[model samples]
Target: MSGRIAHLADVRGGYALEADAVVVGSGAGGAMAAANLARAGMDVVVVEAGPQVRPDDMTRDGPAFLSKYYWEGGLRMLLGSGAYPTMSGRCLGGSTVVNSAIFFRLPDWVRQAWIDEAGLSGLAGPELDAAYDRIFTRLKVAPTPMHVMGRKNLVTRDVLDRVGVPNKPLPRAVDGCIGSGDCLTGCRQGAKQSVDRSVLPEAVDHGARVMTCSQVERILFEDGRAVGVEGDVVDLDGWQKVGRFSVRAPRVFLAAGALHTPVLMQRSGVRLGGRVGGTFAAHISGLALGILPDDVRPWEGATQGWGGFSPEVQGLKFEALWGPTALIAAEWGGLGRDLSQMLQDVRRAAMVVMVYRAKTKGSVRATRSGMPDARLWIPPEEIHVVARQVHKLTAAFLDMGAEYVFTGVKGLPDRIRTIDEASGLLSNRLRGRHMTMTANHVFCSCPMDARADHGVVDPEGRVHGVPGLWISDASVFPSPSAVNPQATVMALSDLISRRAADLSLLDA
Candidate 1:
């Protein structure tokens, strides 16, 4: 609370900072690592690519938030068979600042898979448990109470109950949520405990300095060991470079998320072998709208309050979703009177989404100018499975007394009045071309594996061949987590920071 948070917007001329360690991000991973290192009596400097916008300055205006906090002004696209827009946070707190405050730990199966298949040791025992405990205590992870769940989440609970599926309240990293249904756009009430308000502040209190609007373009290595980083200080509006800055440290940590970390490494001339940017995976999702009998005001509740898994699909999860009126109107698929009518009845609209544990693989490459180019491929079999799962969800919504349902598929009718018709529509012709696929949970681009050819980092999160360089973000995930990964990323960062602290002590 008493340390430095330098805003480059007010800064002029070139600058330099010396620290024991330089952290290249300030999100879930970087903030946690910086806090731990500072607590271990190391001088830490955290360089963030985005501006530091306080919670009181946040708003419910979706477009304004996207333009200010989202990567590439919310226009980042992935290319392959089809083009898909990817959302990632570009702020002092990184993706955690703009994400739904869901806090899911690493699933048991995912933990076991990493241990067995990825050769990740010490991932399941008391070591990992202590890490989780520390992070959970810091973030105040808990479930949303029923009183704040609003009517929309209650409808989802009812549908799941009618269909004989079990559901529970989602755990969120919030303290005093008012259920404004604007978690995706950042919490305006300061109730959601993102890292910017939690660990990053703690890091500052412990003598860590945070540099906002400082983008690290490349890592500086000497004799095959990381020594520091260099980049430009950009303005908050256009992110245009205004001045050059540098940081010199004994160690460097990169927690720049899965999409951009590999690109940063490639631009820095670090060869992470063939697997640096390969093996990208995500939980592809589809959405459906249910026209309720009354005005439930879906946007009044917790953004995503309750969720459950179906017995039909092995790794599929269903959850209630709500968005802004403008976003909902765009998805309604009508014009003129029809669109106006739908917007007028928006209060009666509730949404349900299905997330499939996709088996597809993708890659991210660094361009000559240091930007990332992502290519994702969804297999035909996986597309069919998703289509079937979405059909089942739509049928359930229609059976639960909803007047009608709208599947967001392009070739399908705007609305389905009967369960049989929905089934036939999806079963007969649902392909990748018809459905729009987007993902928020991306992983395994720079995984941690014992095999040098398969991973970029070791189990301890140290970059394989680069001493004093470490990675402590979602990029270290050996595979898709099949759930929200903020908690997992934080826990792993705790472990990595502990290791880095010990190494720093020896060097001292």
Candidate 2:
């Protein structure tokens, strides 16, 4: 599977590449679309804002990976009642490269809601099922084996079973995982099936050209139609401008993730009214920490292996999460001597994260410099819901034989010794500023809807009032997907590519 890849940092002068189709990203959506389009005999070129970090170059150091691959050096902040840190990858494979390898089909209920509320048709039928099947087979999605499950995972499963809560092993997109417990830092063992290691290679095999360090700053329009894109090539080391480049094509697809896609559209002067970057949403999450009696070594096995939805709390999902020693220490919540003592028990620490389907809506506005400034507002009712879920999670940890639990709230007690103690502290209404909240799954900026007033794109992903322009990313979701969105993003992109192929645009 040999293909051509250009490292723009090595180029000295301005350049231009011509193609039948130009994709402005190389992540899950862009990679899948490029692969399918090239396989259909279209000359495709993928322009990526980040440098290419090959599997061999991947490392196990958490901070190092975040510094190299994360957007804004992993310092992206969501401004609102409280400042919340948001993370998104900025590499050849995009967020999929730095995410936990979790895979889930778009739930049937979510599909139906799109059809009913957003006027999206054909998505609740065979079309979506077929797309899921194709992606499942390609990524070798499977559940983590018991042998590979770490102590933290086993504890979570046991506690859920004892408490009469339904639980199961999480499905992951991997082939030969050795479980270094560093999926977020990038799979150093090359076992996790990220797009850079999977579909992107297939696209390249089909003759799609990939240009790393090439940021598409604007879309090239001619006579009210998108014809190509232009941007500057930056040095991979210092991120300084090295040269300028452009790609001319008959068609262009925006596959950048939710945060950047809308910004790109605004910078390109493609106005789909105010809906282009409105109605932003995410799965707001709460973090809980537990102290175990024995050494669990949370960082030794599958990073996130056991999780399930709580029947007691609708729209709340519980999952296990493990981080590096440094991260664990920071979240341990103590100063000086107390923190030093907690660090000694870091090896025995385990964490459970609760993700709630938030009802609050947000927005993303492009700054004058073309960077995204995201503002998220969580209502009072939603804050209470998250607080209640956090209390339940803390109790579950105690029931699992943990010594004490730490609720990740800013102005609360550092540790809880019993369920009664947790109940007392959580009785007070939690506000957005006091609760430590963050989101990994973001969606619904440039949504797909039948009505032009409701969204920016139609059901087929074609942008309204613009021909030869399409958006196939998380940004096209009409609302927040209650689960992880990587698989859904890939499936939707595949559907968009197939539709584009049927249009005969490439034959022009």
**How do all models score by TM-score?**
0.95, 0.95
lDDT of 1 by residue, 10-47 (tens): 54455898999999999999998999899888999999
Report the C-alpha lDDT of model 2 over 321-373, residue by residue, as the tens digit.
88566556645657877777776667788887878888877898889877888
- lDDT value, residue 335 of candidate 2: 82
Candidate 1, residue 24: Cα displacement in angstroms equals 0.9
Model 1: residues >4 Å from true position, as ranges? 424-429, 503-508
lDDT of 2: 0.83
lDDT of all predictions: 0.82, 0.83
